[model samples]
Target: MSLKIALFGITRDIVGTSVIELPAPAPATVGELLAEMRRQYPALGELRSCAVAVNNEYANADQPLHTVDEIALIPPVAGG
Candidate 1:
């Protein structure tokens, strides 16, 4: 299966786009997905302080993920 991810802030720069598709199989979790993404895009190293959301709600690292789930990365904010 394929999962669509919406990248934001530093994540967008790391991924070079606002969206990305991830491979599926062997189960997936918010943490696992983020880890995999970090592995795929080392540039995301800046995402150490990032949080994740599933279906518009803050998700825990251990939260299970489905192949068709909507995932988004909410990185640290910096503004006045």
Candidate 2:
């Protein structure tokens, strides 16, 4: 299944875009998707410590993601 992914925080810079498309296995979970993302974008290594959100709501790594779901990568905030 294909899903739309949104990048926030530092993830956007790493990906060089605010959005991307990804194909995930059936019955995909946030964790599974993340793993695939890491495989696809080795530069996204920092994703290991990032948070994930589905359709604007915080999601756990184990949460099952439906096809076409909007996923966002949210890294921890850092500022002065």
Candidate 3:
């Protein structure tokens, strides 16, 4: 399955793009996708924290992913 991921903040910087296409296996989970992403872009793992959103809602590690789902990578944010 092919998943489209929208990148934000430091994630975009690390990936060097606003979006990325990842080839994932069927029945993949958010956690699995994250691990694959970390494998491809080790910099992503350096962040203090990150979140994955599917269809505009935060996804859990066990959340199942679909190819047609709207996915986004939200990096940690800091404000003064």
| Candidate lDDT (C-alpha), each | 0.80, 0.79, 0.88
Worst 10-residue stretch by lDDT in candidate 2?
20-29
Task: Please give the distance, in angstroms, between residue 1's alpha carbon in candidate 3 and its true position after superposition.
Answer: 1.3
Task: Evaluate model 1: give its lDDT.
Answer: 0.80
Ranking of predictions according to lDDT: 3, 1, 2
lDDT of 2 by residue, 17-36 (tens): 99887755443889987777
Please tell me which predicted candidate would have the highest TM-score against the true structure: 3
Per-prediction TM-score:
0.82, 0.78, 0.89
Model 3: lowest-lDDT 10 consecutive positions: 21-30
Off by over 4 Å in 3: 24-27
Better of 1 and 2 by TM-score: 1
CA deviation > 4 Å runs, candidate 1:
none
Q: How accurate is candidate 2 locally (lDDT)?
A: 0.79
Which tens-of-lDDT digit does each residue in 1-80 have in candidate 3? 88899998899999999999876453389998888888889998999998899999999999999888999998886768
Better of 1 and 2 by lDDT: 1
